[model samples]
Target: MNQQLLSQVMASCVNAPDWLMKKRQLAVLLQERFKSTPAAEKIMAAWLANPSLAQLEQSVGEQTNADQVKAAGLHTTGWVNLPLFTAANAYPELLQENLMEKAISWQDSQLNAMHLALLNGGRFIYIPDGTIVKEPIELTVDCSLPNYHNLVIVGAGAQAAIVEHQTATGRQPAYFGTELLLGDGARVDYYQSNRFSAVQNHQAVRAYQAQHSVLNMYLALFDEHDLTTDFYANLDGQGGAAEIKMVTIASGQQVQDVQTQILNHGPHTVGNIVQNGVAKDKAVLNFHAVGKTERGAYGANSQQQSRILTLSDECKGEADPVLLIEENDVNAGHAASIGKVDADDLYYLESRGLSEHDAQVLLTRGFLLPVLNQFPDQKLREKLVDELAQRLEEKHE
Candidate 1:
């Protein structure tokens, strides 16, 4: 263990509670299992020297109450990864004995003193064929830095199904990056949601699916004061299917840039995307859907759709759908629309003895029901709905 690195990380997160400090220590310990390359060392050094911890904590305090985090609940199961760099080689030995492996990569560059970087941490998860998980697996990342880099990788085997959820919280402006890989004949359902109080930044999500695999993703973004987000999806497997959906509500001068890329690399593949955006106050929302069919992707089918509803006169919304086809036998289509609430729909509901507020709520609920109903966890779904309702109330007021 490098005491200097430990001391630096500890000092940078001085305000964090002892429990979180212990968690970081555990994470650092787990880092030892993988062979550290030069790039990994440099990234670790930058992570230790991260300068935005204080600002992130302050921002988190302003946007989210501590009680909410505590109430979110924490559950863990199955084979847990222990810290890698402990005096007891027991953990590392267990990993080696079990034939487990990990991967780490990082990229950093600066132009005219402006920083651009990408950091990725991934664990190779090998589930035996036909393995099934009843409880969802969780990966929580708390980035405390300005100009950040993050990535997560999940691997599954044939006939395997896993549910993974990721959450990011804190202040400090950051650029978040993510990539997911699924194997042949495997299936994965992923859920990710983000909330930012006052961070100015951008984020991207990318995934690659293998033969006969299925990937279903659900994403929700709320409250990113003056921030932008870019999301992407790619399907590379034959007889594979990809379903992507996102819901975003931006207020208070925030700007959302949402992009989706679904590429068909195999025959008989299917891809679809549905995105909804709502903006209030001076916020701006930009939605882009791009579907590409490669030359070899004969008999592939793809469709993309985007919808935006503006609630305030000062708010702005943009929707663009693009399709690229190189195979004559492939089927592809795109649709996009940007508009406000329909006055007739509101009037009809009001005529049924519903108040304006109730009518608006009904409209909003109708817009989000398609995605919300797909959530298997009722508790989590209700929590998300409550959060959305609170944000909507704040926007209307």
Candidate 2:
């Protein structure tokens, strides 16, 4: 960790609440204690070599144009959007939620602390009780500024969809963290898409679902550099449910590590994870899916499926699916695979008047279609499909 920058950010927290300041201090202390853990090792190295706070401040000072925001499939309407810094000030009651408290883990404490201490720009969104949002809420995230955090809350019986688009056009180390709280009976469809070419992205999204609540998460990652993503959902109340679907492409020399986990802490809860990835050239892609049922989570159901397709001999991939069930009444299962495209399928397509490159692209899309079809937004689904096709075409051309 950069002690000089850390000291500067901590010193600048004069305006933060006493509790928040104390939390930041504890986060720093935890960082020092767990810096040597496996999960913290690679993340800390990435941060220590990343750009300084001064560069991020300058980048955040710049404005984002409408064209860039529109390209991410988002608009500036229909959502209650507030700057993350003063969100609690506008709604003083929100301070009672204690955001990020449940999302913290001993494994990633260092990176979590870094985000808490150095967060620069982000948004806060709240959905009230009994409200049903017809249109999806859209937000554009500029990744050039680095550490950006988002806090979203959905009240009891409320239902909504949120789309977050991250855009990075240049070389930078980017961190995007989200903490979502869903009240009882609330349903949320959260979608995130990444358009990064030169940025090394470190992203995390943690959600807590209350009784009878449902959470559906979709992730689309098409990056040309290293990327690390951690998505976790906690079913904290009886009958809560969560499903996570992810599609990604890692080409060139990129390295991508994605982890998805669902923790069943309530009776009759359901959790599922699905992921698909295509790796080409010298890229390396890894997906880890974990489903854990707590001791008293009776009648819980946990399932996961992960698949990876390698398009080159030089490329490497791993699909790891794990299930840990502590309750006898709970059900758990997992499936994982890492393999190359089929030569026979390619030959058949070529015989049907398609080029080899086109055949490979078609097959890859077909492999990912199951998860893609689950996206609730048709326009966002089309956008992801187009992006996937474009990247595949670029690789084959």
Candidate 3:
């Protein structure tokens, strides 16, 4: 990274939160740790180089129409949250209230640090304590850029649901990072879904929950070429709970790597992770999950399950689930499996008149349907199913 480019990016971050400034400073020291620019960073740089909105649309591919956003009662933003934070928008009151002091830390790794240092602008969404937001807040990354770092703070007793996405664009690979801070008694339902054309799509999430809080996360991948998510949750307060679910479908040499870790820091904390995926063609899907009970978390309960079903003889699927228990009073377990579709179930579906290929598609869809069903929005659910169906059909063809 050149000094001039770094200075220019920093100049754009005027009035950035103090913590973010410190993080940027720390990033310089760790530059030697990471040798190359992350793939998502490259895409962001491309979008940044061409700032015209029209050209951006062409390069990154267009997102949902404005009409669809309005019909769904959603809020839309063209760039990442950075621009929103840099400029005073209509929601100044909300922005001022929820803007965290510092978003990223030196602990987030070299790639995340590089993203933070290079991000020109950022977006913020703050849910005040005790307030309930029924409608999901939608963020569309239609225009590629380096605005990957986002901060979401849910105050004590607050409740909200957020659906974030990067529409399938063949042009640029994208990277996104989010820090979710849930105050005591807060609750949040978070969903991240992606479909990109032969480009790497990456997201890193770090979350913390206070006492009696609840955090539910959903990851959905449809026809992704290369997908990677590093998700970590910290249950730091007693009675806190965290649940993560993921569903993915890969075909034609697509590669996916998903890692999730849950740490119980307080007694009586509960955590669960579950993922289901389908691989066809020469596609490969790999899952890694960890459930940990700390020494002082006497009553912590943790579990993880990772399952991948394969439809093609050439496909590859692997699931690795790990459990770490440091306290005797805590309960923890993990289950992992990779296998072909059930022969009996395939036969049963085939007996009903479906062709062999059709049977595989039907059963594959059924295997991953459970995770999608957990979404609260029926519209989103239907849309995801439609996309999944399209991806499945591609395999059949």
Give the best candidate by TM-score. Answer: 2
Stronger candidate by lDDT (1 vs 3) = 3
Residue-level lDDT for 252 in candidate 3: 86
Superposition TM-score, candidate 2 onto the true structure: 0.87
Q: Which regions in candidate 1 have their CA more than 4 angstroms from the true location?
A: 1-130, 141-143, 146-169, 347-359
Q: Is candidate 1 or candidate 3 better by TM-score?
A: 3
Q: Which ranges of candidate 2 are over 4 A from the true structure?
A: 1-3, 36-46, 49-51, 54-79, 104-108, 197-199
Residue pairs clashing in model 2 are none
Error of 2 at 234 (Å): 0.4
Best-first order by lDDT: 2, 3, 1
Indicate the TM-score of model 3: 0.80
Q: Compose the digit string of candidate 1's lDDT tens values, residues 1-397.
A: 3465456457644544454345444444445555653433443444446533332211112323334432222123232221112101222332332211111122211210112111122222333344455666554444444433322333355332333333345444445544455667767777766544334555555666778878787777765555455455566778888888878887777767776778888999999988888776688888878888898999999999898887667989999898999999988888888888888898899999998767766777787767766765676677778867776666433
Model 2 per-residue lDDT tens digits across residues 208-263: 88999999999988766688888999999999999999989888888888989999
Error of 2 at 164 (Å): 0.8
Candidate-wise lDDT, in order = 0.57, 0.76, 0.70
lDDT against true structure, model 1? 0.57
Over the stretch 216-281, how does candidate 3's per-residue lDDT look in tens digits? Answer: 988787745677778889999999999998888878877787788999989999999988988888
